[model samples]
Target chain A: MAQLLPSVWRHIPERYSLLGSHCENCGKDYFPQRPICPTCRRKGKIVQKLMPREGKIFSHTLVHAAPAGFELEAPYHLAIVELKNGVHLLSQIVDSDSEAIQINSPVKMVFRKISEDGKQGAIAYGYKFKVVRNAAAASKPGKPVGKQSTSSKK
Target chain B: MNRSGIVGYGTSVPRMRIKVGEIAKVWGKDGERVSSGLGIIEKSVPALDEDSATLAVEAARVAVEAGKINPQKIGAVFVGSESKPYAVKPTATVVAQAVGASVHMTAADLEFACKAGTAAIQACMGMVASGMIEYGLAIGSDTAQGKPGDALEYSAGGGAAAYVIGKPAESIAVIEDTYSFTTDTPDFWRRQHEEFPEHGGRFTAEPAYFKHVVSATRGLLEKTGMKIGDFDFVVFHQPNGKFPGRAAKILGVPDEKIKQGLITPILGNTYSASSMVGLASVLDVAKAGERILMTSYGSGAGSDSFWFTVTDKIEEEGRRQPESVFEMLKDKVNVDYATYAKHRRKIKSL
Candidate 1:
């Protein structure tokens, strides 16, 4: 817990939220944020952009084998999501049927416990995707608040 | 002092539920009798990765969005829960950062058993009313735990509710007044380093829940000179489906008056989130001028009661977006006892 605190502290902003960096010059977005834009280099004006929480599934895989600290959540689905901003990022798909998961399926982000150190350790939290249900009634994937707000009320 | 009011509210219920029958079957008890006795058909269960902090953050995000206010402007954040993720660290800080609250703000974890969430609200009301802050975010969230085979297991559940409080003019519901009744009657308690809480059984009634609820409620009604008939809706802390009804009867309130907010039968007791969630459900369908009375009970034990009047802003702001409590309640999947155990950590790997 002690050794992991610093990294956890540093990543709290991005981990606890769906924050990405947007390049004013290139109009491109990057998840986990980027200090510099590769497309426009020094001329790029980098700003923290609140990324959309809804997206379409690009691809997915099932994790049958458990990793350290994730044994209990074995056989969870992981997918590369094409966010509304067109930034494809990898995240786990939870709270939905495995058979229901498919490519191009609409997904939305939710706050969930990602990991914990142990009995008395700090619980690490992050955003995870879930296959959106009630698609026909779905208004739209998302609406960015003031341009940078995360996800739609949908 | 500036008047404080509820600008916006949000709820978070996990996707999983374990029916009373599923849990009762594991203990060889009659499922029908157990559910009928407790008036709970099923209880919400959190995912393996979900806890008080995560669920609280979910609710808070919706509230922040619904309030249409910048998170940076929220001057205080208080999370009330019995099942905080970290024992040493503050869950309020996690929610504060998660909601993008300003660095120049106050945040803390509050505990008062089930009413802790309402207590968080009262604290914010104080700070806001005193002109100390423009707005405050109060949350009640819990991934409540109960011992296997214990009576509480059938009703203890996971859920969260968040309320963004600001000035009356900016509120969707104006808070009229609040009252509380407290005493050192240990109806329920979890010892240090204990996994589950212990209770005084029927003692939780009469001397604990009832005493506090009735007293606090009548106290507030007297203070405001409002009659039971004046309230269009009433919400009382429900440890089980039966208790709220019984409390209403004792208060001379009609059974139907609290029917809308009596959600414990479907969602189980969300602990600190209990009454706050109930109030949110009522506000979902309440009209612009409707009056509401809410009382919350936490087993340490005490009751915090309040009066609120819905405003035209409730209709203007709308209720369905970000999902209402009724909507979230409908989006659920029932898990078996084994899966429930695994999720609740009743079946730990070590």
Candidate 2:
């Protein structure tokens, strides 16, 4: 019989965000948060910044050569997305085709497991974006899988 | 000038190589398929589990094999790549751990189209020059895949190179001055999360390759007040063999100076590490008194040029690795076009 490992599931803040620091002096943004602005070579005066999850696919590719342990998931799409706040990012595209992914396909932020640490067995979790559906999909009669409530907006 | 030359070097070419004839067969063409106007005969594909980060680790492993210091003393690990395995995930941590670097160190990834490798070196050199650490490792590796038959595919290959930055006494070469120029232009760019990059070829050729590289190299020479003739060698980013040749002529650098880094004729363009890896090759046979000038260009219109002076330390670090830069390139592994498509996962269901 397959055994389930003990798991510690926790919500990573309702206002979860990928915080960055935008130099008030030069307007360049640093991701994963930086104390000092790199461009201005300034010390400690940059403003706290938060970029939204919603945006569009600026470009994308189907990863036919899947990473190790992801062979079955070959041809999965990876995208470069631009968020509404003008932040550009790279992410995986869920439930879509590589060809159909265009320059401006709308997307929304979500959280998913990226990879397991090769050693120590720690699982890493991070925020990513997926395609945003139309009003029709939102108003559908049945609840869809993988849908999370948007009440805890960042 | 402080010596920041390559102390160690390594590369990763896929076990399998796919040929043009095989690609022609899959498309059901009798012969001579244009392959989308890119003159790529084949490409190296990673196994299902391999990625840029893993390849970077392999390259670094080879580079450090003959190096004098213990791996545990490495103060920083920097990876320069455009096709990183994860968007938000920093591959440097994994690479650092894999290479047995000190836990307390700076680790990060850099991306500037293909110039990511040299940028990582510049950052490492800054730390080394500051005497913050005894040694720093910089790697440029990529598994950049071009859309089927696109212009970029033929020239894009999977590869990596590593350099250990340390004190001049133990260093093979010391880094001199570095100069860079930047402009906001979209000659060639991959948007935030894009897979395939977009380019205006003529525009990319002129501005991204010609204009910026010329300006930056001239700017560096002007700042240092050194003539092109003073350098024993020159290495430029290899978007294609032709681009560097053209740029070399335009900049008054000699043909032999440009010839030192033509691995692209066999391996294709390796984004960020293209020029630095070539410099590593030049360092393999360079004498203690030689001088090298390196120039790198990235998309979005930016260029970095730096000076290097070879030292006697190169003689002390003889071959002690499984795959020295020369040995790695000499081995063979080939795959057909169908396998290339299968490896790249290019087939689409109708």
What is the Å distance of residue B162 in model 1 from its true position? 0.4
**Regions of candidate 1 where Cα sits further than 4 Å from its true position:** A135-154, B318-321, B348-350
DockQ of all models, two decimals each: 0.23, 0.01
Instruction: Output the worst ten-in-a-row residue range by lDDT, candidate 2 chain B.
Output: B319-328
Residues forming the 10-long window of minimal summed lDDT in candidate 1 chain A:
A145-154
For model 2, the docking class works out as incorrect
Chain B TM-scores per candidate, in order, are 0.98, 0.91
Residues A31-61, candidate 2: write the lDDT tens digits: 5466787666744368777666578888887
Per-candidate TM equals: 0.94, 0.67
lDDT of 2 by residue, B105-161 (tens): 989999888888888888888888788877888888887777776666666777788
lDDT of 1: 0.87
Runs in model 2 lying further than 4 Å from the true structure? A1-154, B1-5, B20-42, B317-326, B348-350
Candidate 2: Cα lDDT at A48: 71
Name the candidate that leads on lDDT.
Answer: 1
